[model samples]
Target: MARPSMDTDTRPTRLYSALRNIKWEYLVAGISGGVVSTLVLHPLDLVKIRFQVNEGYGVTNRPKYNGIVHALRSIARSDGFVGLYQGVTPNIWGAGMSWGLYFFFYNSIKTKLNEGDSKRNLGPGYHIMAATGAGFTTLVLTNPIWVTKTRLCLQYDKPAVSTSSVHYKGMLDALFKIYKFEGIRGLYKGFVPGVFGISHGALQFMAYEEMKTLYNTYRNQPIDTRLGSAEYVVFAALSKMFAATTTYPYQVLRSRIQDQHRDYGNIRDIVRQIFKYEGIRGLYKGLGIYLWHVTPNICIVFLLYEYITNWKSNRPDNHS
Candidate 1:
């Protein structure tokens, strides 16, 4: 018996066509997966900061947690589980917006950028451009949530944690409280560093896209069949490490700006104060923590994203 010929029209020609056909199931799956993973992993983020900022206080010590499990246990012992989830609500909002927008718009933008050029996939510039757009958009949209989260997370160390000091109980509370207290300017305390941290997104997406493309090229060679789960994990770790290292100082500044007290007039004055007190290093107070936090976070994020994308692509109805 002769084999049947495949129909050329069955294959998608335009990238937008493929993106347009993506089911809501995949979008939901991606967003939910990101949320769960972020919430679960946030405690390590807390511990990483503790270690990072300790150096500033003259506590030159190594992190107690060698891995996530140890980090959780240490944090629970020291500050309780509530401590582990100090800023969870805002974390949820920030992660939801950041990841949701990044994935959704990245696909849409890449599709549009590469329109009529199917053979040539999106390059590093496309990844940078897509991430830049997503970064600025998410920064503005989620800045209030992030400010609230920072206040909540850093509030624990204060002698008295008053509602006046903390200000916001939840997302909506934070938004309304800021507006009532400081007007429109309250929501944008760290606009400069917030925008600077957009470079983190640009670097992250650029590195991830470039690395995945390299992996695809390597896998196609006769010497290698495909990347295994372990290979994927390694690539994710390396990509995150590079991105985090390159853009970590901006993150530290963003946290400081967002977590400032009412005394600080604005971002410019705050930057000046940090420079006056701590010098250039003051602006980068929690850089070590950021680096540690981002490596595992990005690893999980990309790993989950790839798995979700692959699962969606393999489903029956995903076909054109």
Candidate 2:
């Protein structure tokens, strides 16, 4: 009974094999994390938009509440908790798909890029490659979800009488209804800005990767071992902030394109409208609120993800 050969060229290392096997776990974790985070943070997201869009609404400015709590209070007082979670269905759908795609492609791309590279010398280029791959993948996979989420979130307190068609009730309802009303085109109202929004995703991954690399470099240690909990939070927050700042105007346009009620002749017309009506300032309408909303959320997400990944990787059974 000869023991299995450890030096066989045909067989991959245990760690390499294990890493390849966790694709489903990555998807599940991404989707579940996204859903839970969106639900918890949605109320704030609502307020953030209100503050961004409406000038006279006069929402509270307390740092603690940000926009969501104020919106929740206003809605609850005016409407109910129902208002707090106005487009919950779309949010969940968007989050689940967006995050699932992000993590799946991010891991896949990073793994492929790392295949021949020595683990001792992974560089900034690897991070950029991974981030770019994740960003592009997320853009295509979740654009429709974003379009739906924008519409649902932007439903006003006052309904207007218009000639345009109205479709969707919540998330799934909206999805099916949109398809029925306008076919495939209805669900992709903001395709142009949506594609542009890829910049945000790319920047996010780039920032995260760069920050991780920088930390590892400065400390002269392996990132997997040297990155502390606080470091993860800091890196995540900084990355999100940088990404948000660099591409915020596109984000505003993307939201507006999705949520608005207008018959633009084409993407050019929509862009013209955005610039004409909102001006330079209008293009950046929700920049502040976005940073407020996205930064902390990303920080928490990375923190949680790193902790979980590290814990699982370090488990006795998972060790190389």
Candidate 3:
């Protein structure tokens, strides 16, 4: 036990290992899966964003959208079909960067942390730690991308003026305008809550990794080895649902902070204002829509990721 605990050679140096594991395949798999899923599921993501920031709570001319169908109809009638994909550019960028960086850091960290023995295994706690590290690193690097995405997604109400400050034509446009008007800090609007939301990914990966480990044990196979697509989808869906359900409220708060129509000085102010006006229920405004949106999204992403990683691992040069 002492010998195993003291094993130093298996422990990786942090920076070099991370840099070395930055494979192009990870980027390809993550970007491809994210872009595909966002294309299919962006409408739901838009609805959830509208729901979160719609503090009017069903008031006339203020309700944004009465319900899902109503929201869909409203977006179509107001902004046309493209409205459904309002901030899709930044969303693609964000989603692609997010998952790409996440998988890269996650696998690198997992490989480093995994037990250096024949019967290598990791429990839930280790999984959580690895995911937490990965999540934090990804969030810090990609917060600006996410901030641009949120603003673009919520820019549904078009102004009559072509040069209106309200509209963001594209991702690069949003970045330039945000820097000009709100300065560098504007691009980081919801960064605090976004950081807090790291728990969501941490919890998701922990549950996902643990579930796969348990499944492999039951099947008497190497951990996460030779799993079928259905199994991967099931594990991905279960973990995503769990994480989203448990850590959703922070998303609402983050959305509110990032809403271009509203301005908040701080997270405490946002929370207090929401509590005063919207009450406890306000915290979970779009959970239903989010669940509907995130469930399939995660499943599709992991299904793609699993297959992609499997292919890479089975390549001739990668074999032991």
Once superposed on the true structure, which residue ranges of model 2 sit more than 4 Å away at CA?
Answer: 1-22, 49-72, 116-122, 157-164, 314-320
TM-score winner between 1 and 3, please give it: 3
Better of 1 and 3 by lDDT: 3
Off by over 4 Å in 3: 1-23, 57-63, 115-119, 161-166, 312-320
Q: Report the lDDT of model 1 for residue 313.
A: 57
Shift in Å, residue 298, candidate 2: 0.5
Q: Whole-model lDDT for model 3 versus the true structure?
A: 0.82
Q: Write the per-residue lDDT of candidate 3 for residues 204-226, one digit (tens) a residue.
A: 99899889888889888888576
- The residue pairs found clashing in candidate 1 are none
Q: How does model 1 fare in lDDT? A: 0.66
Indicate which candidate wins on lDDT.
3
**lDDT for 45 (candidate 1):** 61
Question: Would you estimate the TM-scores of all the predictions?
Answer: 0.76, 0.80, 0.87
Task: Itemize residue pairs with steric clashes in candidate 2.
Answer: 43-68, 44-68, 168-174
TM-score computed on alpha carbons, candidate 2:
0.80
- Taking the candidates one at a time, how many backbone clashes does each contain? 0, 3, 0
TM-score winner between 2 and 3, please give it: 3
Cα-lDDT of candidate 2: 0.67
Please state every model's RMSD to the true fold in angstroms: 8.8, 6.6, 6.6
Among all windows of ten consecutive residues in candidate 1, which has the lowest summed lDDT?
Answer: 53-62
